[model samples]
Target: MKSPKQQSGDAAERRAETLLTGRGLTTVDRNYRCKGGEIDLIMRDGDSLVFVEVRLRRHKDFGGSLSSIDQRKQRRLIIAAQHYLQRQRWQGPCRFDVVGFDGSHEANWIKDAFSA
Candidate 1:
């Protein structure tokens, strides 16, 4: 049994996935988590590996979903990404992306949103 909020989050992630796929990115993993942190989606863009964070906000106040990803969260995401790459044999270039969704509009993708 999932709570309404969790269900909503799942739906939002699904929507983000669809939008990314439409842009030609291939999904490699979902909800990848470890002791360090969690990554919402792991995708591939051309030859680069991408780590994405999906945010959903009900209103435009306080910067909406885009602004919700503050410094601390970015740190966690970076650490998680490093762990993921270490586990895999991949030594190629990678970047962090953000997908913001405001309830009234379509999802927005912010590529290379941050770095290590």
Candidate 2:
């Protein structure tokens, strides 16, 4: 059986995916991973590729989910993204996005949340 924490994270990722697809984005991939890092979700937003990080924080003791993504994490995401793009031979446009959860039904989406 999945642990409560794992289940919560899965549910949160699903919520983020639903919110995005409802807004006209098409899901390209989920849980894209490389040796460098992991991308929670990857979606097509118009002509661009959006690499997403889904962060769910049920408590506030360590601050919010948004603040959890620091420089090191950003670099890993970037490296994974680069690997994905290269393997797919994609040369259009790409951006980083963040889906933050605070024990809520709705997630907060930040488009172009970070740069590589």
Candidate 3:
């Protein structure tokens, strides 16, 4: 059984997926895991592949949800994305995005949040 924290995270991912799909992005994969790291959501926006990281914070303390993804986290995400691309043989355009949820606040979607 999933712990409450894990369940909450799943719900957050679902919310992020819904928000992205509402904006015309289609889901490619979810919770993709490899040895290096895991990707929360893989989506397609137009001809570009999108690697999204979803973060949920109950409070805006210590920089909040968006600030949680620091350089180390970004590196892990990049590593995971590369692994995915190699497995899928994807050579087309791709970008990283971040979806942050702070308590009951609206979602904050940051496109091209980082480069590989």
Q: List the residue pairs that clash in candidate 3.
A: none
lDDT tens digits by residue: candidate 1, 31-90 = 999888999999999999999999999998998999999999999999899899999988
lDDT of each: 0.94, 0.92, 0.97
What is the C-alpha local distance difference test score of candidate 3? 0.97
TM-score of every prediction relative to native: 0.97, 0.94, 0.99
Task: Tally clashes: model 2.
Answer: 0
Query: Which candidate would rank higher by lDDT, 1 or 2?
Result: 1
**Full candidate order by TM-score, most accurate first:** 3, 1, 2
Residue 108, model 2: Cα distance from true site in angstroms: 1.0
Which wins on TM-score, candidate 1 or candidate 3?
A: 3
Better of 1 and 2 by TM-score: 1
Error of 1 at 102 (Å): 1.1
**What tens-digit string does per-residue lDDT give for candidate 3 at 2-115?**
999999899999999999999999999999999999999999999999999999999999999999999999999999999999999998999999999999899999999988
Q: Model 2, 41-73: lDDT tens per residue?
A: 999999999999999998655878888999999
